[model samples]
Target: MSRSTTATVARTQPKRAVLAAMLLLPALAFGLWNRPVDAQEAPVEIPAPATTLNETSASATAVFAGGCFWGVQGVFQHVAGVTKAVSGYAGGAADTATYDQSSNGSTGHAESIQVTYDPSVVSYGDLLQIYFSVAHNPTQLNYQGPDHGTQYRSTIFPLNDEQTGYAKAYIAQLDETGLFDGPIVTTVEPQKTFYAAEQYHQDFLTLNPTYPYIVVNDLPKVAALKQLFPDAYRDEPVLVGTL
Candidate 1:
């Protein structure tokens, strides 16, 4: 079955029960049973952007699309100063933002997350640091891990001119670092509309922690965040449900 189809089937109660049972097995056995075919991405150690936004706002919003939003959203939700991390669609029209439509990969929409955060506690540059380092692999083109398509492409939708400059400069800085295996392919897309995904998709990683995809492809990201950014990692994620 395709990833999409497997995800759909996993949502059913029967499949979920089976998955929960699978989780009870020994760690090595469970891992062997559910290992993904695609090699997982490991967080990179990249430096802070030489340039950062000077905005004085109490809160700010940023949109990012890097492969599946499940892991992306999960990573930000556990970060300090992040008010909310919502999985959604960007780089396309509102009408084409639905998962069903975007899944076709021709709607020009990539699975994205709109992150609301406090600049005072965590500057835009800090968020950029977390984004490029642990959230997803920016070097992959039109895909990440087991997923493949334009909908999984790496991108950033800057909300303002300052953010635009910061994103572009940060990508350039990372490219110069030679930290990634390949050049960063993340695009800086501005003036795009961000439509929240369907209710079921919101907070998916937290709600479905035992799901095969979440376990195989996303949980490591949260672990990486805690290990790499202990000061910025929060024990209790600021869930979208509470926002």
Candidate 2:
């Protein structure tokens, strides 16, 4: 080839390379940007298995903490699809935990519950709706009403990636829309060992209808839930007469 031709070809190579990169850049950016939201999107990480329950399986489990377990558990128990809502502790150390021990906050536990439900009847998202609007106040940073401590803090202990995704999305929606004046501080974390609250605490509302706290603070939530989601509420408790 002539020297002039060789020089022209060499100069053209740089422009060709730039053009190729430009062509590929959008495709690369598209993949990177739309990359499936990893499990949960934010600080919360949900394990993969929890959200995808086997279809052959009849039920799924969800854990949440909203102030005292009594109010949280009672609300879920009445929800039509929820087969069980056992108040307990989660997202803390794996030590053997109990109500008394967790109350101190040394155990790193929160008063929580393991809710077993038929996803066919209610969705994880629906359960969360009740959780946010009626289960407990997400705005309360570290306390719910009179209860004060990390134990009583609002939290979602997602069992799997889907739950994690849903939770983070919901919080993001609530935050973006300005649902709360302050930031939504509800913790979205992985599930941990769940220790059931003492039997007496299981159905505190039923067991102690006259308890001042139940009458004053907890019952209102139950009423609001029934009013809000009438179809989901069941008047009869699973434990029956005594909760």
Candidate 3:
């Protein structure tokens, strides 16, 4: 099934039995149906931003949209300094942020995550590094993996002028390095209100690790985070439930 069709079905059923059946399908068959034409299966190694923000506050918030929020949130949840990583919608009005509306790809929303962290422990630049490197492929224009829509576009919503400057600089730095085969399509959007997704979507990767979608697409992201950033990776994910 196509990603959109699969998403519609998943939402309607929301049952483990249905998901388990998907898991039983052969991996080859699953790949044929769901994998991206040019998926970034492996994480890239990118340099830290030469310019980073200096924040006096203990807590800071950063929002990013890069493909599905499940994998992006999962990746950050494993990072040491992230206090909370929430799956949500951004780049649209609050009323349009609901999953059902956002799924249509015309809600002006992108599936996104709000990451709350302690800047002292993990710099915004560090999170940006992980975002560009392991969370999702930035070069993909408007989709990630089998998912295709404006809702799956890669974007960064900066909270302030400092973040805007850093994000733009980092994007330029990554582009100049020629690390990615194509130019990074990730965009820096004006800050938008973020609405947390429904309860079922929170900590989805942690709660449903064996769900076919998570198994096939998201698990690799968490693995890459652990392998690529050992110092930043935590053994226990800081789950949304705990927040």
Candidate 4:
């Protein structure tokens, strides 16, 4: 990382560290902390693809970067077919996957979520619907809501050519349908190494339900997922208990 980028991440780390500390006190966390609500824009329920896989196998992995992984992971964890939704770094080298280093914006990594789901229970296109809708805004370019930087970019890292075809077609469908006020900017890239984030970052939304950041930014996405796709919503979330 460049000297300037290192300085930027170094400056950001302390404040986030302090926030982590303050999140321990529930009463204080609720009373003292307040954040501006994200715009009231809701995830639009787009149409399921007319064309989809003729059949899905036992299970598959899909990695998506649509802003902060916390909300994305939280949203997918509530989906019925999703067995696991892990917060991680993708679209970059494996060695530079560490959070602090990636935050400097030189690693070409995006805060992403690796979801393991049963295709029989839910097809990949179903996951894409939730992703395009309640998971995160696909039109936000490199940022999602409050978070900014390439690390939080909107990207879809497909595991294979079939997955890539699905993502590309979906983006085209949404764009053609004019699902959002702005154009969709989500990119479909070949899947690369996905390094799981640190333990504290795992299951963050479930474990830290009352954390200020989760309350203001992430929880609502889960709520929206439940509201928008009631059939697929699961009351309990699959969480990563340890790193």
lDDT of each: 0.84, 0.67, 0.85, 0.80
Tens digits of per-residue lDDT, candidate 1, 111-176, equal 999999998899889999999999999989998876778899999999988889889988988999
In angstroms, give how far residue 143 of model 2 lies from its true place: 0.7
| Candidate 4 residue runs with Cα over 4 Å from true position | 1-40
lDDT of 2 at 204: 60
Measured against the true structure, the TM-scores of the candidates, in listed sequence, are 0.86, 0.73, 0.88, 0.85
Choose 1 or 3, whichever is better by TM-score: 3
Q: What is the C-alpha RMSD of each candidate to the true structure, in Å?
A: 4.9, 24.6, 4.6, 5.4
Best by TM-score: 3
Q: What are the per-residue Cα lDDT tens digits for candidate 3 across 18-45?
A: 3555657676547634655344656898
lDDT of 3 at 62: 96
**Across residues 1-243, which tens digit of lDDT does each residue of candidate 4 receive?**
753333224424533554555556666666634544444346677898768865447879999998778789999999998888899999899889988788877899999999999998988889999998888888887777656788888899999988889789888988999768789989887958788986667776786776566776688788888888999999999887776
lDDT of 2 by residue, 1-243 (tens): 742233223222333343334446767534543444221111121122224323334798889998878778878877888888886778676564765466666667888978888888877777877887777878787687656777778889988886778788777777776545467789897756676765556666666654444554567677777777778788976552233
For model 2 the TM-score comes to: 0.73
Q: Rank order by TM-score, top first?
A: 3, 1, 4, 2
Model 3, stretches more than 4 Å misplaced? 1-24, 27-39
